[model samples]
Target: MDQTDREILGYSRYVVLAAAFSAMFIISPFEYAWSSMSGHIGAIYGWSPEQVALMFTTFIIFQSVGMLPGGMLRDKYGPRWTTAIAGLFSGVGILSIALGPSYPLVLVLWSVGSFFTGFIYNNAVTTGNKWFADKRGVMTGLIAGAFSWGSLPFIFPIRAIPASAPPETFFTVVYIMAAIIGGVSIVAALLMKDPPSGWKPTGWVPKTKAIARPSEHNYTVSEALKTGQMWVLIVSFVLVSSAGLAGMSNMVAYSNSFHFTATAATAAAGGIALANGFGKLTLGTLSQRLGVENTMILSYIVSGLFLFLTIYAGMNRSEWLFVCAAILAIFFWASLFSLFPIAIGHYFGEAAAGGNYGVLYAIAKGSGGLYGGILSTMLITQHGFPFAITIAGVMAIVAGLILIPLKYSPPIWKDEEAAAQLNARAAVGRR
Candidate 1:
């Protein structure tokens, strides 16, 4: 390509990335912000804690299940239309909740919204994989990090809602959320496009024996499913993600149980949110240097340690220690957001990133959600928070051990350069 073409590619790639970041940020309230709304909504509706938690489980189940078809659509038709559709679903879903007549209706509407948001999430992550193949870790981290911190803007406002506020205030906040999520998502979706096959950034060069280049060959979803490594990765994903989800889904409630004041508890939750964002940003970049798997191992182990410390903080009634430990645990969880996508692209090839990774991620998240949301709630109610935290910590440590086997596995696909190098060497031997 000439200078003009390079300029166009450069401009389009960066702009699309920016748009993906913005979309992830706007759409974040659909998931992460819900925790802030849960207690108030429960109080207003005269629902029990378990009932409120069931709504979260409903949202998570649909959100994860929807990613399969949503990812297929993005791979086939591209992100533009799919993301626009997601924006519509998100707007309508949030609005319906604001005007919902009953609790069941609210749950259904939220689930529908969660389902569509998967489109936005998958499209954004896949875009980073497609555009920044050379810088996959950093770009994926930025997208995930945006998602990690996106709830910050809404956290305070949502938390401020009194147990018995006028319904108008709640409706207004949701309405504003709908508009921002819908408007920004649609705009960003329109701006995105996939780079042409075999495209690379200007002035970039591939290794003579490059391995796992998507340009040479990509794994189809079916083909990727047949790999043992994929299964291992998925199971590991489920275990670690479940731990993170459990902590995040119950962080506020856990703080309250420790006798922290409402203000302090909410602040602790915010601290968790910040830790999530910083973990993605820092660890994502760190993965580039340390390797994604190595970084994941470190993240999981450290998180497990801090999670155990959280139990100690609760026993000692040290709010600061509790908050710090909670933040570190959450930080490790957030790192997975970056690591998994990057690993998927490397293992499965970027050509089928949207579909293949989508399938794996959906299963991982669906199972993890169940473990964290309803299961954690059950454990907390019956065995108390300490037992739940112990389970989560053990799962995190187990996840790290599961990934240790991957160190010996080679890339599933060989790039053109690597194939050619092998062929040339064989010819020399024959001569």
Candidate 2:
């Protein structure tokens, strides 16, 4: 293909990836279910609120542990196999949520499914960098936005008003979620595959900030572990992740602190996910131009600011206060989620990225565990959302500070000429 044609194809390929991920995201209605049915399920099952809440935390923990295996799968057979299997798992998981024997058992079973929750999106990120080397920032931004409340569309099917329906009404909601998510997820998994090496899409430029040839830029898991970049990446991902979950676990309370009604709070909570999706798309693309590190720093810092505002808005009870606070939260939280993987592939060779990232990704659920109960108790005991959110906001801001100094790190790959020289030497070694 000609130059323009190749660039167009490259853009098209990246677009295809984003669409696939968004669809893969379509079936994950569980995030929305917490607020949607927590009360109903708790009331009918005679379960304490804390016990039911623990299920969401359980889901996150399993999801994190699951990333280790998932990341290994991504490396062994490539993303298609991992994503397809995950889609199937998610389908079964959701189906089980639809039909439950006991609330505690259901939570345990459903939490098991959260393990596969991230396969599609993470694969899209790792693979998209391979395909769109030239425009990662823009691509990352688009990814950030596309996935922000990826489950937003699925909310309608599962949203049952309190007092409006019997507890058994939840069965219908689960059925709707399972069908919608299961069908789309399976299709998305079927369509997924990584581009063959040397298959650079048209119009794409393989621009690395380094002098090493692209192929020569090999950072194995061990090598990656030795670098400040790895630790920086880890610190960056973990800090932001902790902050986002803290806010996520408490957004309902935060929303109402400002006088928003239950309907408005629920709407706001769901919107955070949608907004986070847009943030992923926009910020992911923006990272392509500004550099992933820079973009990520911006996201966290801005998120931190918005989080502070959320507290103030909650305190003051202003209507317009959090209108944009929620949007910014989406931007920063999703930005961290969407771009860090791209940067990982950039710094560590793709071969080692899976394992190295697995360690980082797997640890994320533990942060949920730490902050989930800890933050909740502090809030209930300490008299408000402000103290907890303030701590998280501080954490998010810290992520920005930690990542900003990463600009000095060398680029992972160089131009073709150097790569050929390395390839020639390797050929001799083989002989």
Candidate 3:
């Protein structure tokens, strides 16, 4: 246990962990359940598929871009007020959608809500990065996994909504969803907090020989941006994230493109939600033993392979194989959320984790959203699902290969004087 955390908060850090998990869980339906609900939304509004895809793209843009300021604010001011306010807005946004506004208004409301979702997401994941440095992989993975599987309850319910269901039926579900998201976020906000700046678990020493060990120096967001490693990580993130987001957003449509039964498509979607969550939990802990870089390379490549297999299965119209392949693809792809944050903490140091990771996520994931949503939609419209899926899978493979040559080393300072100053800064951060 962290003695300082206990003294400061009068409870175990797991309390904070629980809060983070709950906050992350509430935001899951926005992303993961979208595919299930999107058709219904389009049905009610008479909107084209491209228009609906643009709504998702808009949400992704706001969510990813909003993380930067959210993270910066949390790093300076703690998470309480920011999380609370964001949660309130997010919940209200969902409730507004239930009122059956115009398509433009729906986009406006969703984008605004999505912006707050990013804030909560940044606050939740970075809580793990800041508090559980001793067990970052597992702890962070658990919290991040909540964001995936938490959609299960919502997904199943949303999937159950028949295509012929009226707007009132959709309204009821959204109302309930809004209440859960908003109410839980406020509760989480009250519980969420950062550990004292230098706190670590009592009696636990960091292993210098650990493969994913923390860096000796803490780099500010700008300093981290200067490193070649950061750029490589961004590119890799863009590729893998693009693939994962595309798969997630289009899973149901992809399943149906091959003329599979509604039951099979629903099962595939549920399988993805479950597999993605569990994969993050499993691979995250596995990374602790195997090393982050190796795990990433293996996971990304395997994910790509499974994505290709998914295409083959879909083409052959094998319902079971399609579900299994899609599940495997998402299972391995989902680890990106857990592994990347761990990498950011290890490579840049935990002191500025929120800000540093926010920059990476905003750039990579925002672009990923564009590719996965708008561009993929274009490709699917013109060339078909197979081409777009193939492109995404190839990119995933390339993303893994890009990490093969990345080895962590101390940053190269211009001179001994600069090195000393950097080390001094890092020492101060530790204190």
Candidate 4:
């Protein structure tokens, strides 16, 4: 008989789940709330829109790239120390922005903080992979979803801060936010640990009903790299992520460009946050039934269609329609976060999930960040929002089509092991 979680760890795995969820929640504002906060930040710092946008790009670049090393560290040393240190640095990094540092200095601090955000993120989501093999979809969705909607409390207040608000007023809010982020993170970090290798829930059997089964063999990072499937996943991730990031980073400005009222724009931003969070959970659950690959195909195509609709609404100055379409766009777009990690865990095996997914995530999101921030911005400057957003939408649709051919193949070792065992069993039967 398999040992229960209580027998092995002296507690329910939900304890670890709560810790991972909380850690993800606290760090959300670093990305999700940025658009709402950036106008005020730019106003106070006497920076141009271009400069503020570049800072956001910087954050994305560091945050995505930092995941690889962070994942390797977590896989090796465990989550406790890495998360504690990340929490500290992430807090200080955001707080430093309120001190009115030079542009370059603020960029350096934000980059450092964003780097650790990756650590917190990698630690939090992979908890589901480590602890809940049976419930990977639902658990990962919940944790990943937190990274989006957790920004809710911060977004409205940040948006409410008047353009003419005094620097001290903004600084006070920053100080409070920094404290909350650091304090919550440290507390959550204490509760995290990886399950023993090959751990599974007591008496659990792998379900054939689910679309993707757990792999029988573990593939190391180098072995996984040689597969065509990994490269396909990378390309698909980059396309959808670029669309999502562009929407998240630029929605407020895009709304303003359409001459929408402040109230309407704020509503749209809030809508994106809420929908983005819920989408991960909803679609993640659905992926288990429909299969991850099939879900990805549907979600990406629908996400692209919504983006095009969003552009139409904006162009027509239909405030509510624009808000609705943007919400829908993000709802589907954000599922990539939940789905991709589960897909990687399924394909490569959970043994090196953190590092393998980290490598894929870093490369894809890094490129997406560059395209979403710099390239998209340049396109908007020259061709306007309609053209830039259209390009993003088309990319998303193409990404979905790219997944039609992806099917599972066993890792190399699985084949070898099966052949060797078969020969030995044949000889024994003959004897």
Query: Could you tell me the TM-score of candidate 3?
Result: 0.94
Model 3 residue runs over 4 Å out of place are 1-3, 211-214, 408-431
lDDT of 2 by residue, 1-431 (tens): 44432354444564556555665455445554455555556666677757766766776677667766776677667676677677666766676665554775687668666777656545555555555556545664555444445566655454535566665666776666666666666666555555544444465555644311224465656666676767777776777777887777556656766668776677776777677677777777666667777788888998988888877776677756675686577567777756776677666655555565666677754564556544454565466677777877888889889886677654443454477689999999999
- Summarize candidate 3's per-residue lDDT along 376-431 as a digit string, tens digits: 98999899999999999999999999998775443443454487798999999999
Compose the digit string of candidate 1's lDDT tens values, residues 1-431: 52332365556578888988987888776667767877767766677888878877776777788878888888888889999889889777777667555877888788898898888888888876788877777889889888868888888888887866787888788889889888998899878877764456777664422223433467889988887878988998898988988888888888889998787678777887788878887888787777777888899988888899999998999988888888888888789888888888877777788888789879998899898888899899999999999999999999888898776673455465588789999999999
Model 3 gets an lDDT of 0.86
Between prediction 1 and prediction 3, the one with superior lDDT is 3
Cα RMSD to the true fold for all candidates:
2.9, 5.8, 4.4, 2.9
Candidate 1 colliding pairs: none
lDDT (CA) for every model shown? 0.81, 0.64, 0.86, 0.86
Off by over 4 Å in 2: 1-19, 140-146, 156-160, 206-216, 257-259, 372-374, 410-431
TM-score of each: 0.92, 0.83, 0.94, 0.95
lDDT of 4 by residue, 16-37 (tens): 8999999999888888998888
What lDDT score is found at residue 150 in candidate 2?
54
